[model samples]
Target: MRRDSVLQIQHSFTGPDQGTKGTLYLVPTPIGNLEDMTFRAVNTLKTVDVILAEDTRNTQKLLNHFDITTGQMSYHQHNSQSRIPQIIEMLEAGQNIAQVSDAGMPAISDPGFELVQAAIAANLTVVPLPGANAALTGLIASGLSTDQFAFIGFLPRKKSEKKAFLDNLVNFPYTMMFYESPFRLGQTLEDCQSAFGPDRQVVVVRELTKKFEEITRGSLADLVAHFDENKTIKGEICFYIAGNDDPSTDESLLQAALDDMPIKEQVQWWETHESMSTKDAIKQVAKQTGINKREVYAKYHEI
Candidate 1:
C-alpha cells in the first residue's frame, strides 16, 4: 500500500484527551500483521500529545493507517538516552506521550525500558497495551513444555560469549526461549547442541502469523543436521530447549572433579564419563559444596 494511504488514516483519529497530559502510554505495534493493532491502543495513540517511536517512518505508516496524526518523534536505541530526559520533562510538564517499538511490545528486549524506568522514578503514570508478541506466539505453537520458561531474547553474536551464555543456561530447570535470525540460525542451533547436548529436545518456530509459518520439533542433533544440509533458512526463529529430565547427579563425584579442576572442566569430565546434562553436573557440585547452582554455572561458564 502507498504510504500516503496509511497517513490519511492517521489524520482522522479523534477524542484524545487534551487534559491530564503527563501519563505515559506503552503501545504495542503488530509483530507481523498490521490488523493486530488493538482498538484501545489506536485510540490512545490518536489522543496522546506525542508518540515516541523506535522508527518514525514505520510508525508513521501505522498512524497513517489509523488516521492518527498525533505528533511523533524518534526514540530508538541510538537516540533514546538523549531523548529520554526531554520526554521526562514533557511528561512532567503534563504533556501525555505514547511510546512504541517497530514490532511487538516495547522494552521487551527492545529499547524502551529506560523511558519506562524514568517515568516510574519520576512518579508518572505508565500504561501497557496488550498486543502481538513473537516470543509467546512461538512458545505456544512450538509444542515444547511451556508451563515455565525463560525468555533470553537474542544471544550474543560473539562465539565465546554466546557459547558461555548457552553453557550457563544448561542448568535452568524451566524451558528456555531465544530469538535467532535466519542468517545465524544454523550456528545458533550448533551452539545449543554443544552447550545443551546433541540429544536435548528443542522446537523451532519460524515466520509466525505469516504465510510461510512453520513449526519444527526434534532433538538438537536433528535440527543441527537439518540446518547443516539446508542451503539457507528464512524468517525469524525461536528456539525452545527442554530442561533436563534426568535425576540430579551425584555430589561427591562432582565435587571431586571440581576440587581438582575448574567448573567447566568438571562438567566436561562428568558429561564425558557419566553422560549427564551440564546443569545436572553443576547441581551435583552445588549440592556437595552448599553453593548456588547459578554460581557454579557462572564459574564454570566463566561469564
Candidate 2:
C-alpha cells in the first residue's frame, strides 16, 4: 500500500506544479447538516489561499468546526461588486481562491455572480465544486411535474409587483419554483391562489435538512388554509406550483369558416378546412355553437 501510494504521488508530481495563474473556485457548502460537507470541499477550503464568504461569522463557525484555519473575508451582496476587481487582482497574482455562501451554492440566487463575471472577463480559470441546493431538494419532494420547470429565485417583495409576477404565471404550463422567507410564505401562497386559482396544486417545503424540515402537499386553497391555522411559520420556504392545465389555441380560419355557414355546414367546413382531427373539430364546433360535440358529430355523419 505504501509503495503503490508513493508511485501514484510520483506520477502525479512528475512535472512542475503549473498551479493555476489565479483560479476562482465556486464551492458549495452544506445547507443544514455539517456532515453533508464533502471531503474534497473541506480540503479545498483548508488549502485555498483565501476563501471569500457571504458571512465571515457564519463561515467562521463552519471553519472552526472542521479545524480549517484558512482566512475568510466578507464578500456578500452588498460588497461583491466592489470587491470583484481586488479578487481578480489576487487571482492574477497566482493565488488560488475559493468562494462560499452562507448555505448551498454561491452565485446561485445569491452573491458571487459579479465576481465570477469579472473573473471570466479577466481570463482567469474558474472551477466549480457542486454540493447542496435547496431548490432541487424541495422540487423533488413537491410531487409536481419535474420534466419541465423554472426556478424564479426569490419573488418580488412589493405587493403590486409580486401580484403582477404571479398573475403572469397563469398561462405558464411548466412547474415553477420560488424561494421565500417564512413570514412571507402565507402571503405568497395567497397571491398564487389569487392568480392561479384555488384549485391549482402547490407544494411547500420548509426548513429543509434541519430539525424542523417539513413538506406540505395540497392545492393552493388547501395550503393557504393549512398555514392560516398554524399561525407562525419558520425556516426557509421553497414553493412549487403545478403548471396551468388549460390552453387557448388560434381560431382565425375556423371563425371565418363559421361566419356565413349553418351549424352543420360550419362543422363540416371546420373538419375539412381546419384539417383538424374529426374529434377536435366537433369539440370546437360544440363549444362555438352550444351544441353537444357527440350530437354534432352524429348529425354530420362524421362520427
Candidate 3:
C-alpha cells in the first residue's frame, strides 16, 4: 500500500453524521410503545433535513408527540424505484435525511435496505441507530434456546411456497423467529405444526411492547387447538419455535407430508405408495382423520 494512501485511511474521527457527503441515518422507531424510542434516535431525526417514512400519516403522529417539526416524505415499496434517485440527489447536495419504518428498525420486512445500498454505492455516509425490534423482543422472552437463532421475517403467502419454505427450515437446529399477520394466523400455525411436528414447543408474542401485549407458550398441537376456536384474532404475531435436533420418526414424517399436501394428493399417495385402490384410499383417509369422505371428495372436485 502507498504510504500517503495508508494515512488517509487511518484516524477518521468525525462521526458519520458530519461529512462533506450528506448522510442517510437508518433510525429505528418504537415498535409499539412510544417510550421505546431512544434519545439518540429522536435527536437524529430532529437534526436531519428531511425524514423518509414508510407512511407519512403514521410517522406524522409520532413526530407530533415528540414535537419534532421535521418534514417527512413518503417512501414505500411501491414508489422506491423513483424515490431512490431523488434521495440520492438530495444526499449529493449535502441534504441530510433520516429513513424510518412505521415501527421497529428500517429494512426488516420493511423498505430501506435499497436506499441504504444506494447511498453506499454513491459513497455517501449511512448511519444506523439501534432501538426496538419485534423479532428480538419476542426471542428474549420465548423461553427457547436463543443462543443461536434465525429471524425469518414472514413466510410466502401461497400455500405451496409456504410449505416449501418451511420444509427447508424443518431441521434447522436453532430457535426460529417469524412475523405473521393475525388474519392468516391459524393456517400459518397449521403449516408450522406440519413442519415442526405437533410435539414441538412454540411461543407466540403479540403486539410486543404495547398496552395489550400478550405472550403464550404451548406445544404445536395445543396452539393449533387454541387458534382453531378463535379465528378472529387481531394484532401482529411474533412466532417463535424450536428447531429439530434429531431426524423425524417415520410417523411424524408421514404426517408432515400429509399436512403439506391436499387431500387429493394424499389419496394418490395412498393409492401409489400403499397400493390401495381409489375407493380404498378415500375410505382409509376418512377412517384415519375422522373427516368425512364427502368433504374430502368436495375439495378435489373444487380443485
lDDT of 3 by residue, 82-196 (tens): 9999999999998999999999989788669899878877767777888999899989999999889999889999999999999988878889999999998889999999987
Give the candidate number with the greatest lDDT: 3
- Per-residue lDDT for 1-303 in model 1, tens only? 656522111111232433444788889888777888999999999898999998899999989998998988999999888998999999888898899998888889867899988877766677788888889988888777888888888999999999888878777788888888899998889889998888989998988877898898999999899879983788778778888666235554346556778667766776778898988988876776777889989988898
Candidate 3 lDDT at 91 equals: 93
* Candidate 3, pairs of clashing residues: none
Ranking by TM-score: 2, 3, 1
- Candidate 2 whole-model C-alpha lDDT, 0 to 1: 0.84
TM-score of each: 0.76, 0.78, 0.77
Error of 2 at 37 (Å): 0.8
What are the per-residue Cα lDDT tens digits for candidate 2 across 146-241? 999999889899999988888777879999998988888888899899988899999999888898999999999999999999959988889899
Model 1 lDDT on a 0 to 1 scale? 0.82
Once model 3 is optimally superposed onto the true structure by TM-score, how far is the C-alpha of residue 165 displaced, in angstroms?
A: 1.0
Better of 1 and 2 by lDDT: 2
List the lowest-lDDT window of 10 residues for candidate 2: 6-15
**Per-candidate local distance difference test:** 0.82, 0.84, 0.87
